[model samples]
Target: MNIIQKTDDELLEIAIPMWDDLIKYSNKGQYGKFIRNFSYNLLLGLNEVEVGKQFAKSELTRSLSPDYDVLGFIRRGEHVSCLFRVRSTKKEGEWLGRMVLGYEKGEVKIFAASVF
Candidate 1:
């Protein structure tokens, strides 16, 4: 559940589960779970982020895809961040998911998820 001790390969493993869970929850009509993945700073009733997650969730027919690529990890001040680049074509056009994770409170959690 944490990435502090995780190597690059371990971090990549974490991202896959995150991606699978998001798609699973979204497909089950659990948008609330999707919204809860965000960090504290990003909040709103309806906005770009929420819509994008839901849209991606809705469009994803498979739980996980081979199109996902880990964009690597970097330290940003007090936080360590990881990015995963994802591509899916279950819809009319190509979709990209830039999923992000930030290590905080002794655990790595989904801090941001955006798809376009």
Candidate 2:
């Protein structure tokens, strides 16, 4: 279930919807929904309270738009990193978004995700 082996279209099929959910949940400050697709290890590494605080304070995370453009994908080991050009609904700038996908328990899951 290595996502790196998936074709661009196949990868987009899986990644885009997840990315959409990420942006949607982040904007709403819904920590649980934001991490719904995260891998077990990623979930374990996150501090829910810290994330909630950040969500409440970070202007960027709370203002993401539903629209985005897929920049491309990068492969590393069993993981595939998807890049997006994301714009803020409440601000006048764009940001680079990254979502790393890989297999966990034979299912595709997010290993890491961030807006930088």
Candidate 3:
């Protein structure tokens, strides 16, 4: 993997568009804010990828109940790849989703995501 290191400003620039999209489509309202904050925290490296991985692994043993979870992403070149694993304690159904975002060479992209 070609790991791309980004400054905080650069990460924000990349994240805003995605955040806007989530706001427009998400029905959670203020709960969506939590997702946005989580995304920013991840991009700022306040939440490490390792922690995300751990959450992914331990999700099966925990309860979900519409709560937020840490998501993980890797920046490669001009694209960002995200991993989201959804776990529901109330049921046996679990799902994992992955998304990729690409931007123009000099442009920025933003996103909000939740995972377990």
lDDT values for all models: 0.60, 0.93, 0.46
Q: Encode model 1's per-residue lDDT on 25-108: one tens digit a residue.
A: 555556677556566654443586656565565556443344566667765544446655655545444455666676656656
Best by lDDT: 2
Q: Over the stretch 4-50, how does candidate 2's per-residue lDDT look in tens digits? A: 88999999999999999999999999888899899999999999999
For model 3, the superposed segments whose C-alpha errors exceed 4 Å read 1-3, 7-66, 87-92, 109-116
Q: State residue 116's C-alpha deviation in candidate 3, in Å.
A: 13
The C-alpha TM-scores of every prediction are: 0.57, 0.96, 0.34
Ranked candidates (TM-score, high to low): 2, 1, 3
What's the best-to-worst order under lDDT?
Answer: 2, 1, 3
Error of 3 at 76 (Å): 2.6
Error of 1 at 109 (Å): 1.6
Task: Between candidates 2 and 3, name the one with more favorable TM-score.
Answer: 2
Clashing residue pairs in all predictions, respectively, total 0, 0, 6
Instruction: Report residue 72 deviation for candidate 3 (angstroms).
Output: 1.6
